[model samples]
Target: MRSVKTLLVPYYEHPTERPDAWDALLAAADRLYGVVLNPASGPGAAPDPAFAVVAGRLRAAGVRVLGYADTDYGRRPHAAVVRELLCHRDWYGTDGAFLDQVSAEPEALPHYRRLAVAARTAGARTLVLNHGVHPDPAYAELADLLVTFEGPWDAYGSLAVPLWTAAHPRERFCHLVYAAPPDAHVAAAVQCVVPGAGVHPWGTLPHALEPIR
Candidate 1:
């Protein structure tokens, strides 16, 4: 059977505020493979036990779970993202992580490699470098999943998915974009090219333009 693709929900809040989000997410999960939560999205937030509760619920219901951190954005301390993720394992209760904003430059790869190692050491699988384009060949092997496309709806089809899928197998790739008016259109284009398209509609456009916290 073909492996199912999952939608990574940008973790919008702690456990107390997530009922609506969880309901909507589970509804989506009913159709798709699973959901990934990004606890690193909320500002001034410390790890919450409630996250663990929800994570347990999702896993019990048979969702393939994952978590995230936007390591490449702004002045957000990269180490802090790592620390928070490690501490809140109970909150995410997933098999692995999607480390966003990794370096594509060849020289910088090793640094990211270390971060991947760190994440792995903390009992999390490390999938790094979500470059929304066809990344360097060296990057393909570094992470469990290379997020090849992450951008606005308009840019989805014009960039990496086509070129990357043509060269790589459908199983080795994934893509994420904010949900927008043309989301289905974008998903159709991506799935046509690569069956491994993982589309994440962040409910609204991600505050990607502003510095991700």
Candidate 2:
């Protein structure tokens, strides 16, 4: 069996909601590839002091701490997106940016590419594009990782990877399934994912966010 070290968590809630959960997540940081720390609305300018502490802790443990920034499906202005990336870097010292709500359209490719560059310029070491689906193959070159699947277990079970994606490293892809069943079900879901791809299964809303032991 492949080790679950490839897990990448979407940890979208504020640190204050569940401080214990955040502690648990940091404890198992070595097993994870990274985590997305999203504030209430979006990547706000003023950083939450609590989040800064959490982000620093994760980074200290060698876990990649990523700041979340919504692209609004590529409709939002480029300058606005870049500002969020900068805030993540300057405020929380996040190692990367999780560009959420990304578009799969070919035209939107340039938009994301630009953001990726801006993120790197602002000290972002990694760039993850959350398309939540298999996007045009051209998007593969724009970021370090791509979220190819984001939904419930049943839908994820039927997910089919495009042939083109096979040409890229499996590690470049990620899969997220919410409302997961028991341990056996989670194991089954991981089996369905391509080898080397990151996979995470959450059990409830405000997801359990437990470490996969």
Candidate 3:
């Protein structure tokens, strides 16, 4: 049977450092929702030739290459965030933006909506907002995908699904669970569960996706 689950990977390692991991990710192109590209937390000071190459390769493989940009919970200047998106486009040729550190409060919706429009205007075909928790249902309108739950594996079971979220399509929400066990249950349509733990859990690949030795 074909795989029904799609993974939204947020791997933070550089291509040079994890060439094998990148290769493995490419091999699972069919199962990927998107691969978030983060060079120096956000796009670096200058265009990275290596990231550009990898971004191109991912795009060619029919995977969305998302440039990682921090929204700083609406505190960061809109212009600064837009600049990062532009850098991602110019430097890596990414077709999408993954807005991280997003605010979950209802009050921040307006700011995020404007930012979402800016991302699209900047040439982002796919936009994902990482709220890292359930936000106001209205927030769902601002992006293609919303990371509603992002936390350690232990917290996954105790997570309470708000009734408000039931109204939205499952595909609209995603959960990112790190330090996952072999049997970790991903609670959303889009899944990303990794076994790696500590400060850089995402530095490793998801259990279901591994490189052949």
How many residue pairs in model 2 have overlapping backbones?
0
TM-score of 2: 0.85
How close is each model in CA RMSD to the real structure?
Answer: 7.0, 5.2, 1.3
Which residue runs of candidate 1 sit more than 4 Å off their true CA positions? 1-3, 11-15, 28-34, 40-45, 73-81, 126-128, 160-167, 187-201, 204-213
C-alpha positional error of residue 104 in candidate 1 after TM-score superposition, expressed in Å: 1.8
Model 3: lDDT to the true structure? 0.90
After superposition, which runs of candidate 2 have C-alpha atoms over 4 Å from their true positions?
A: 1-4, 184-213
Q: Cα lDDT for residue 36, model 1?
A: 54
Q: Return the candidate ranking by lDDT, descending.
A: 3, 2, 1
Per-residue CA lDDT of candidate 1, range 82-200, in tens? 77557545445666666666656677666676677777777775354466565667777667666667665556647634454566565466666553343244442222121122343
> Candidate 3's error at 67, in angstroms?
0.6
**Candidate 1 accuracy as lDDT:** 0.55
Model 3 C-alpha lDDT per residue in residues 58-154, reported as the tens digit of each score: 9999999999999889899999999999999988999999999999999998889889999999999999999899888898888889998889998
Full-model lDDT for every candidate:
0.55, 0.73, 0.90
